[model samples]
Target: MTALSERFTTARQEGRTTGRTAAVRARVLAYVGLTKPRIIELLLVTTVPAMMLAARGWPSFSLLLATLVGGTLAAGAANVFNCYFDRDIDRLMQRTQKRPLVTGEVTPRAALVFGFVLTVSSIALLAATTTLLAAALAAAAIFYYAVLYTMVFKRHTRRSTEWGGVPGAAPVLIGWAAVTGSLDWPAVVVFAVVFCWQMPHFWALALRFKDDYARADVPMLPVVTTALSVGRQSVAWAWATVAVSLLLWPVATGYGIGLGYTIPAILLGGWFVVEAHRLLARIKRGGDMKPMQLFHVSISYLALLMVAIVVDAIV
Candidate 1:
């Protein structure tokens, strides 16, 4: 009888294990979707190497991995919260009208629950596995985006992209702090690079979706500005990004990279400038605006630029 009871217990345990595995896989994929993997992939491209550079060699593998996990969770939570908050408006925008919540694939309450659980789990994990400073920064980034940017700046201002840069820049700083245990000049440089990079990147996107944004009453820069102004703003931010990136070499001793890094920065920055100028010229000539082209190029440039930083570190 005892042997029979134990066999039944073992069988029950095996079944539970299988069930848990399936449940976990589904939840993880859902969470990954919330993170917007494409965007998080680009964001993490900056994070790991920032940690490596801060350590001035290789970062601690455990800490780096933990920070990435926490950062991904925090970012995903923020995005989920934003989707829930903007479900109504998102359903009205062409680009976002088909997201999980907007399409009724996920209920708003479910999204809210997911966001809360992910947010709490992220903060707890960071606090346990990494420095509190890193954890705090992660939380602040989420709050900045979910509350400050999503709720306030995005709905209220023409320069929402500029204001949103604050949170967008935080991941770099969070990665740096995770390894260094404090904010420093190197972290500041990384933050500046991301901040300046976001301005043009988002402005280009705004140009592409100006009508969607306007129809949604989101108050994006392109929605309120003339094409000439959008072009000029793009040129200005792109130039500023290039200037800021070059300054990194002199700011941190770890920043020295061969002309390989400089070459791409200059060429890409120049291309961005030319595109902006061409857009302005097109506006003047009454030609079609290639906002989509500029928008896609901007994404490529930012991702490649961050990859360049990591490559420089490795080489």
Candidate 2:
């Protein structure tokens, strides 16, 4: 009986230890989830291309590494703050209902503090390893995304996506500044490409999740207007994005953005424009709009275009 009791006690202790270990792991993952890693990946898509273009090829290894890491942290900080502030709305949207804050996996206070730490660390890292302008741009982007877009524009206006694109495009400028220590026409053109590209890209997403936005009382374009109107706006922005992308070759004459980028840019932009028009046509036909089709295509379009930029800059 003494041996049996000791064995039972030991088993219970091991079980408790295992339970604690599992809980700790979950908490750690919850914090990571608050940072929105997928968005950080897209930020990299634009950032690396701009850095390459600005450097006219690969920048120094240390500068590239530092800029990418700092940019990732900055994007993470902005996302965490967005999650903290938008927890209420997120709880209402089914797609976001499983997010860390919404699911109570992370507390708002802890997420807020994490965001601050990330913001400071990212800025410090950038300033130490790259230009001050790069660090400054990162700070401004975080502020714009977290405070202006999340707290104000997103909640109140149908044009939120348009205005919000400013911070979204900041990665281009930030990457260029990291290499060149200043912004220039090339940076501005790439910035405009991303800025104009976001309208159609995000409007397509908004259309797919219109009910979610409406349920949350957010004023996303699709939530505030007809699908037809949103489709028209998307087509307009799609062409605008292509036009701005074309302007990059002229602005970056010495940067080797020649036939390689131009041909692919034209082809890719044509595909994006066609998809946007297809969405509009579907809406007009009173058929299934299938908005996510354009959303997915927009992802491909930007990624491929950025790849073209990379190839052109290197070759």
Candidate 3:
């Protein structure tokens, strides 16, 4: 009958509408994935604490929100640029094989255009909402990450990750500068903490992915060096990360961090160092070190340290 035909047509149109909606949602998620949200999240974790320490308490909500949003976009832009530049190699790495560029979910030309748009927008947002210095630091961090590290160090040297820690540590400085409008010794000390922490944090991750690096012809330390060498280096930097973090206790004297910060620093820092040594010991015994365990713990270590900073500063 005519009624049955109309019902069939309505159902078909509804199905088409649902399909289009789903496609649009997937496209949006693909664009978001290109930003590497996880890394940006970790960077932001360290940022607010640095801002709190610099202010000796909570900063204005508007300023805090602005700094966080700008930092996210800046880091997102840098990550997008890295994806564009590393697209070819990314397709070869097992971990990166599913990335937007690799799977053709996003085109290279579109990715580059997106990166450019993010670059302009992030810088302009920072400059408008925060200080010029904050904006400049964000720009410098982007270039340091996408250019110096991605293009130069990553290609030629085994020590690339170590040398490339600056951009990873930059959010701390950027956040402090946003609050104080200048850099100080405390900022430098915090920067060193993040820089030192990065070596062990990433080396553990690199150990698990070294095979992928080798497949891609990248010169990561784990790819070029022996496991024993990697373990020894990780241990040394782990201890150095702990020492540098403790040094912040004294340098942050006027910033209101005290026993509250000190307790967590000693406990968490010592635990991280112990975990690093555990990896070294396991390697010496010719056993699997479960590098990913350290990798996961490292994330917790830095996040808790920043939490302690926030609590200590506000109280």
Comparing 2 and 3 on lDDT, the stronger one: 2
* lDDT (Cα, tens digit) per residue for candidate 1, span 153-194: 999988888888988888888898888679888678778888
lDDT of each: 0.80, 0.95, 0.93
Better candidate number, 2 or 3, judged by TM-score: 3
Decreasing lDDT order of the candidates: 2, 3, 1
Q: What does the lDDT read for residue 280 in candidate 1?
A: 69
TM agreement with the true structure for every prediction: 0.87, 0.96, 0.98
TM-score of 3: 0.98
Enumerate residue pairs that collide in model 1. none
Candidate 2 structure quality by residue, lDDT tens digits, 1-315: 999999999999999999999999999999989999998999889999999999999999999999999999999999999999999999999989999998889989999999999999999999999999999999999999999999999999999999899999999999999999999898999999999999998998888888999999999988878999999999999999999899988888799899889999999999999999999999999978999999999999999999999999999
What are the runs in model 2 whose C-alpha is more than 4 Å off? 1-14
Best by lDDT: 2
- Candidate RMSDs in Å, in order, are 5.8, 1.5, 0.8
Residue 15 lDDT (model 3): 100
Clashes of 1: 0
Q: Tell me the tens digit of each residue's lDDT in model 3 across 251-306.
A: 89899978999899999999999999999888889867799888998999999999
